[model samples]
Target: MVYPEQQLSERQRYYNAKEIAQYYRSRPWVVIWRALTIVWLFARFVLGLKLDEWFNRAELNKFKRAGQLRQILTDLGPTFIKVGQALSTRPDLVRKDFLEELIKLQDQLPPFDNALAFSIIEEELGRTVATMYRQISPDPIAAASLGQVYHAFLTTGEEVAVKVQRPNLLVSIKLDLYLMRWAAGWLSPWLPLNLGHDLTLIVDEFGTKLFEEIDYINEGRNAEKFAKNFRDDPTVKVPLIYWQYTSTRVITLEWIHGLKLTDTERIRAAGLETDAVIKTGVISGLRQLLEHGFFHADPHPGNLFALADGRMAYIDFGMMDQLAQPTKEAIASAVVHLINRDYVELAAIFVELGFLTPDTDIMPIVPAIESVLGEAIGESVGEFNFRTITDKFSELMYDYPFRVPAKFALIIRSLVTQEGLALTLNPNFKIVEVSYPYVARRLLTGESPEMRRRLIDVLFKNGKLRWDRLENMIAIARSDQQFDLLPTAQLGLQYLLSEEGKFLRRQLLLALTEDDRLHTQELQRLWDLVKDDLEPKRLFDVALSSLRVVSTEGIAAILPTANTINSL
Candidate 1:
């Protein structure tokens, strides 16, 4: 099998020899890091850290042992799991067997020091810990690489979990990431080494994203957004954040002590319907991404807790995902096509998303989709292996040259993760089978207005109609539209779809419903604006500004005073 030299082999457009050597010196400590990660796996599993003398005599599945090791790696905390996750996607650069082991890693972790937690709370609240919390826990109930969370009672008697950045976390992470970034850039272009990618680009994205995550203030805003998005449903629990107590490095949210999905035996013992709980978990998460477009990117068993009320609580907003409206629309369309098994349409959707180059034949990727979706098609959502489908997609990058947008990749990860949680509680739980209604509604017709009303029925930062896409709405209303089975962007369909896109987002919000019909005058005005500026953002800016007066506070959020706000 002669493999032709691929595009990845092209000389690093940016990598330099000095930087290459710098990367290895700064970051290759990870070779030792990887070795230690593996050794830790062996100690926890093959060696049986807690196993007794009789344990060696008793036989158990080694595969299960491997899975346990992976869990421990994730529990070991964010850095290792972060590395594992990155490696999980770049199979071309790493060992397949190792990738398999890493894939099992859970993003959940144990809680850390109460003393440190107290310090964080005190610091963020700009007062003594006692002043911030009337009663603080003796120790942290949860801990991750970057933060430790403590359950405490506020002076007002509110039970809360205060998350504090691990001291100097940003400084530590940046040093290591800088090294890795340098190494990937320097080495990724070398033949027999590129491993089919510019490692630097991946590393660079991680740096930017990771740094954003360290800012608890940003994470708090994300949590607030998700909470609002899911407000219609009481079954979901996104603990409210105490914004006043939050800062760049500290966040305080409502305390939730509940069973993680992984506590299977406990869940069973509690007389809870494990299968139902798992399905709810799956649905809630799907609705978060598919419907809300903002989601907690990391949802391992640890981050998701089952409250006494049976609502699933999602924690750790540090790692979150933002889906641009276009990406969300594309995913909705792809999902619809996938349900119908219109492989050709699915293939073309991938191309539209820049996953596949124009010349790359969709024929090859078609079988790949079918091969993965084979057991999934027409099956109830709960009957198919969602994780397997996602893994297959990641595997396809090797066969075809394409760009898997990182945001979409995270969306895929979130889906696979929720599926894993469901499987843990009920092996028979099939995500694909259960997701059929969502697919059927989207592909066959669309979301019932009621469902749409439940969430995103309000105007946002700028009060405007969600999409007063007058021009296209008028076209459709006027019978000038042509229907095509193939996916075509409805310039009108595009705007009215997102809250930020709509002209009367605020009106839709005030009414809490979307009828989406634009009057003739409005359509004519929209058409004139559309003709003036083809850019959606510019058009939105004009409409939004026209709708309301820009306040000084709005400008403040956009251009926060440099000295007052720490430079990220």
Candidate 2:
């Protein structure tokens, strides 16, 4: 029952592939030129492939070398540009100079034909452009590597933005990616040194994300999900999708009017508070990573906006990252441990989160964690710079078995980009400090009873409540509009009476009173608090058992001084 149109479509695809293959076949000389250039550059810059010892005449500067590579990738076109951008995010895989250069690879490629864009819109929607939009701008508003966006108005008088795919983009990208894979296969075995990642691995990862980025349907869905996630939040805005006009090759969305986040002067002139805007951006970013578990992976300044009403609007949902429930919970737990500087528990959480293998030798990893943590903490307890610590940790683990999970890599990149943007707005802004309240709120108000109990464990040690720490946590939680203490406290108290909690309490008491004289008063206080909850006989039996164990070590004086169980 195939119609003539369907038959023609199939035949067109066949020709497209054949044409692409032929196009690549005609480009062997280009490939050889690029490959040889890359080989020479890599050898000279990375491997020190110098001609003569006497001609040591000042090796080419690293930044200059990166510039040369950028030129080569730029000349090779879209696929290489995408690869360079991906490499820019992996500071652990490349030198800082090269990373700096690669990050500057703008997607501002030259635009294709306006006729082609309008024709694609018409063909994909099965409607005439004249009927679809009352007025459509002939010139594109923005042009990038994959596609271009145009300003248009629907017949219903609603202003909208139309994103049109470039003509034969898939075919061109397919050919480029095919050659990339072929090159990766050819060069992988002969690579002189490990660049921290193989070409095959990088190409495959880039190809998947690249393909996903070009799917307008997926992009529309991503926008809808983001809108759903933040529907109730007044400070955040997600674009409204115009499904009546959206398809794989073309998507339409409500046009948002706002100033670029980088335009601090204009944002301020519009009566928006810069600090408040940055705070909202950071908090929303945190919520995406920690609470929602789905986040916009590419959060550069260009993609974010500050509306007239002070709300932050995020556009371009092509790149998004998701964290699983276990990973999110582990991250929340890690935040708590990190704040407390509990390196041991942090190490365990790292393994539990799959940051390291289950059998990873914790002994070797712990010191590395300690060194990074200690350096970040510096001379003060409250001073925590997340970016510095994360960078140091990445460097420390570069050569080791340590690997950042795929989702985590995006998370890191997004947060780093976010913080960088915030700093550009205000140089004195401290992202870690600004983010602490959000982190504390998530840890203290989590739904899990275990998480609440862990909060208690963190707030107390050796039967003494860390009042200062508890107060700081409360202050931070209060800053969050969503934080509620009553329910969290109730859940924590219920957990305290459970068998697991009781065992943990006993262990804490034993560990505290084992050899320290400082807990003499705290132990009595803690006993008075817990004695009513336990049967008198059973409580006395437990106390007496502990006493016998302590008496054998001749530290009986450090035990509770109450004469009778009644006094306790």
Off by over 4 Å in 1: 1-77, 81-116, 186-195, 363-383, 443-568
Q: Each model's RMSD to truth, in Å?
A: 16.2, 10.0
Summarize candidate 2's per-residue lDDT along 1-568 as a digit string, tens digits: 1111221243333323345446667888865665676566556654432432245632555556677677666655666666666565445467777766775664444678999899989888889999999999988987665678899999999999899987766665766766666776788556443332345555555565666677777778889889999999999999998888887778899999988776789998999888899888998998888778899877765478899998999988877867777667777767767776778878888788757778888877787788777687666434665566776776655555565554565677787778767765776676766677777876666566555556666777666666456666766665656665544444443443444355545454544555543455655654554344456666556555534443332333223322322242
Cα error of candidate 1 at position 227, Å: 1.0
TM-score against truth, every candidate = 0.62, 0.72
> Cα lDDT of all candidates, in order?
0.59, 0.69
For candidate 1, the 10 contiguous residues with the lowest summed lDDT are 1-10
lDDT (C-alpha) at residue 386 in model 2:
59
Structure candidate 2, residue pairs in collision: none
Candidate 2 RMSD computed on C-alpha atoms after optimal superposition onto the true structure: 10.0
